[model samples]
Target: MADLVVGVGLRDGVGAAAVVTAVRSAIAEIDASPTDVVALATLDRKAAELAVVRAAAELGVPVLGFTAAELAAASVPNPSARVAAVVGTPSVAEAAAILGSGGGELVARKRARDGVTVALARTV
Candidate 1:
């Protein structure tokens, strides 16, 4: 399986450009073959979560959502038959652990300005 870091923002903030930027950033950061990132979308839409689930299914790249509490607390159901990882701001570390537990790799933003760096560990 391949790994990708998707930056999910508010629909207002997550426009086509933002999604494109996130996907491009992820692709550039990972530097892997066979593009993994499908599309990074914002969570402003009720269907945003669904979009993520569908993309994850088709691309087989684990979809991760990063946002604040207000969005995270949304009642959107997890759509993946397979376990999916969702994280909130300041919870990047926690998301990394979840990634490990799910046999998925995490591209976590370590330094303040260094952007995200990929980290791999065995899950299950």
Candidate 2:
């Protein structure tokens, strides 16, 4: 099985439960498990989001935070101008996943629910 990383983007005040649910659903699409996930990635601005920290703790994985410039450098299938305006990156979930996986392939695009967005990437 491929090693996986999940990137998350969430609105303020989102809870860990919602983050976990969204991640589970995203990885489930690829027939993967939370145990298969190596890390959770997000923009550095969200590095201190309590929900993200809790979700990573629950999944037994590290949380990787990337700067907007670093995330922007990653090539992603989906880029959002709105996100860029708000966070200085066109792609948060997909780009963070790709970067956190060390240039892995994006296996899943961003999936949004309950104000949380999740994307999956796997190292080749």
Candidate 3:
């Protein structure tokens, strides 16, 4: 398991470079480093997104995916009704990070770049 889990939210057709940059930036936002991250997480439907898969491969981590309803159930610091309308969950990056950590505190809030969003959570 990861000491820190990285949650990612990205649009279709996004590039791997953007995903990598977003994740790296989020990791940098907190005290943790990339090595502390063990997995990248997102909505299950997006888990196989080309950018997501490629980025995780480049980062040397696996991907953990959750269903929309599962993500909706997770409490998050930031939520958007617009996101809920589109993705069926108000929180993706933040909630996925929290859930990926198997219930932990958010270490870094959502950070977006080039249409990719990332959040970090420290495992309990």
Candidate 4:
């Protein structure tokens, strides 16, 4: 139950605001606290995406990015228990699939607070 900041990347003029809204809505559907999730929808650009990542890093929140179907390549700053901020192609199904895969162990859950819900999977 680690707080996950999910970022969605879309094409230019793809209504990033709408996408972000949709992401937030989807996050709400996950049945968790709103503050536990930070959804950022942005256009498919390096600088724009980096800014989002930077902000999340500053906040000490684990960042995740969704582009379309697959995850795009980006270097994320690993501060504390912060894993790589996942950047994938924008797709609700894909996003769900990615998240459902048990992304990884909760390295760091909250920076501002403590007692974060951590989710992890063990591979055989």
Which pairs, if any, clash in model 4?
Answer: 1-117, 2-117, 65-86, 66-88, 67-88, 67-89, 67-90, 68-89, 68-90, 71-88
**Please, what is the TM-score per model?**
0.37, 0.96, 0.95, 0.36
Per-model root-mean-square deviation over C-alphas: 9.8, 0.9, 1.6, 12.5
**Which stretch of 10 consecutive residues in model 4 shows the poorest summed lDDT?**
115-124
lDDT for 123 (candidate 1): 38
- Residue 122's lDDT in candidate 3: 83
Question: What is candidate 2's lDDT per residue for 1-124, written digit by digit as tens?
Answer: 4589899999999999999999999888889888899999999978778999999999999999999999999998989999999999999999989999999888899989999999998975
Runs in model 1 lying further than 4 Å from the true structure: 1-7, 38-89, 92-103, 108-124
Q: TM-score winner between 1 and 3, please give it.
A: 3
lDDT of 4 by residue, 5-116 (tens): 4433333233333444444454445554446553332323432554445544543444443443333232222222222233333232223223433443322221210211
lDDT of 3: 0.90
TM-score: model 4 vs. ground truth? 0.36
Model 1 poorest 10 in a row by lDDT = 110-119
Error of 4 at 108 (Å): 20
Most accurate candidate by lDDT = 2
List model 3 lDDT by residue over 14-69, tens digit each: 99999998888777766567789889999999999999999999989999999999
Instruction: Candidate 3: count the clashes.
Output: 0
The lDDT for every candidate, in the order shown, is 0.36, 0.91, 0.90, 0.34
Between which residue pairs do clashes occur in model 2? none
